[model samples]
Target: MKKSLVLAMVLAGFAATSFAAEPAFLADRHVARGASCESCHGVKAPAPGAKVSSTACMNCHGSLDKVAERTKAKVPNPHYNHLIGTDCQECHKGHAQSVNLCGSCHNLDWKVP
Candidate 1:
């Protein structure tokens, strides 16, 4: 009984620490400037396990056409020939490391940051 109780306390402490260490979205430059959770999430706090939609990002970042055009000269267009369409969050995570979704299938050496 003591062992079980001790284990539960340790697990609870670890869970609390993990939650406290989570990075805040407000740490991002866009959010620091003026953007709020509502800007992307449309709520003060999203429901547990809720996800922000691509449209929420597009509202500020503009359409896929605009993104493709802007990046056409500098880099290979991830937006244009994407197999998964323009779900920006697939590569453009605001609060975490951005990934190049194209890297999953193609060997394109494009650096997505």
Candidate 2:
């Protein structure tokens, strides 16, 4: 019984931490601007820990071709010259800090929001 109690407590703690780590949707600026969960997450709420696909984001944002054209002038255009291809989530996070994937190899100072 004691072992079971301890295991239950541990599991509960892990569950709490996992939920806490997920960003609050309402607090996101995009959501405040009237973007719903479906705007990025599709029609259904994703299973716990499921990610929003790049295609969903591109639906509102633009296709990879459009993005590449817009940023073509930038030296080493981030969109087209990226090591990870056109997966926006690789650098952008709607509810978290965006990373500069280029920083992994190049020292370019790009401001990633």
C-alpha lDDT of residue 37 in model 2: 82
Candidate 2 lDDT trough over 10 residues, lowest sum: 21-30
Please give the distance, in angstroms, between residue 47's alpha carbon in candidate 1 and its true position after superposition: 3.5
Worst 10 residues of 1 by lDDT: 22-31
How many clashing pairs per prediction, in order? 0, 0
TM-scores of the candidates are 0.66, 0.65
The global C-alpha lDDT for each of the candidates, from Candidate 1 onward, is: 0.73, 0.73
lDDT of 1 at 27: 27
In candidate 1 the C-alpha lDDT for residue 4 amounts to 94
* lDDT for model 2: 0.73
Q: Tens-digit lDDT track for model 2 on 41-87? A: 88657566667788987787688778778888888888776363657
TM-score computed on alpha carbons, candidate 2: 0.65
lDDT per residue as tens, model 1, 5-95: 9999999999898766654442275665778878888789877676788888789879888878888775456777735466777777777
lDDT of 2 at 99: 76
